[model samples]
Target: MPEDLTRTARAEGQPLSETDNVEDMYLTFALGGEDYGVGIGGVTEIVGMQRIMGVPDVPAWIKGVINLRGKVIPLVDVRLRFGMAERAYDDRTVIIVLEVAAAPVGLIVDGVSEVLDIPPAQIDRPGQFGRSRSPVMGLARVGDRVTILLDAEVLVADGDLALPAELEA
Candidate 1:
């Protein structure tokens, strides 16, 4: 399923604009038993977990980097980033590569569910929770399932780590 999404994303190879058909589409994945979604526009591809080379002097949540083809992408452990307990990576673990702020990043998730077309009407905007900024863009309600829609740019940029300038192209 991840491969299929990767192929579809690669075949398109273009970030979805507001006028595009995929504007409301989201690629949903699991993290710590909760469902999370990211706008499909920023997604480049999804790949199975592979070797991650350790890097020095970086945050623990930034779990080093991986070399896919010839591109070096920094891997972020979503669980650790969200202050959840770290779990061992299994076969279901995969990387969701995204283009945030013109830099490539890979998020390690438990597994992907599927691509869903959630219309604006079905989404509820998150209220200000006193935080300066939030990674959550909205809450998507589809039937009985509720997915936390994340702002990929904010999710990637939310910490002290300056990713764009540090990440290798």
Candidate 2:
């Protein structure tokens, strides 16, 4: 450690304040009553959930595949993936376009919320959400709500999550 820097911080008592360098936006959405966020850098676009072709061999969490602008992207029910009780779809339902683990997939969320700019400083440290297991990174503030910032790496199940045929490049 540099002697000059260490002396300055010691005088200040508190550790150096970290800067919040938010590079991009997040597509905030909901599952059941909890708010969640997906980094928008990988997002292609958001679309309304439509007729999905069901595949039987897969797990129930894999709701089906949606025909998104002629491309067959698989849809996952976020509520079911988290083992939460799900309700019937309504007008608020939306399919969040996500480019996760190199795949351009669509996640079926209860509803689309808004595009949020969550600064790194405001984000809370990793913690448990009751006994519910989460594959997300941690939580961050969005107005009065604390949205779980999902790790795109585990946003979708590995078995079915593959890069969109067009996005493979």
Candidate 3:
């Protein structure tokens, strides 16, 4: 069995360890060549890239929309949302389906990384004001690399896409 890093305090109210605590799992992915993570609690699923029908008069970041099963959901290319240069989609491209505020939205990423359990102590606040202005919540240290933890709720909520009310539900 995998080691459990989900317990913070013991029965006696003492922490399990000085450096370890309950960790929230995150679904990691790549965007603009950098690794980013989103809390797994909101991730509904990860699907391979599919055809996205274009819509007019929307932000450039909004790639389009996809019909997931019987539901039509909007898709956002995270790279474009971050003002990064767009690259052609390849085999590594994927769409991370997330449920935010009762709406299902897909985030287009370069690729999907492994899920990680990162303790709160391992995440640090973004140092620069510019970083704070972005949708990222914090920077998490996972092994030897630093992963950008995104505020998925905020990212989806703050999106300027114009979708029908039925789809937003």
lDDT of each: 0.81, 0.68, 0.77
Where does model 3 exceed 4 Å of error? 1-23, 131-133, 165-169
Model 2 ranges with Cα > 4 A deviation: 1-24, 127-134, 162-169
Considering summed lDDT, which 10 consecutive residues are worst modelled in model 1? 6-15
TM per candidate: 0.83, 0.74, 0.80
Q: Per-residue lDDT for 136 in model 1?
A: 90
- How many Å off is the CA of 166 in candidate 3? 8.7
Instruction: Please write out the lDDT profile of model 3 over residues 6-38, one tens digit for every residue.
Output: 322122233344454224777788888788988
- Reference-based lDDT, residue 107, model 3: 94
Deviating ranges (above 4 Å) for candidate 1: 1-20, 160-169
**Candidate whose TM-score is highest:** 1
Model 1 accuracy (lDDT, Cα): 0.81
Report the Cα RMSD per candidate.
5.8, 10.4, 6.0
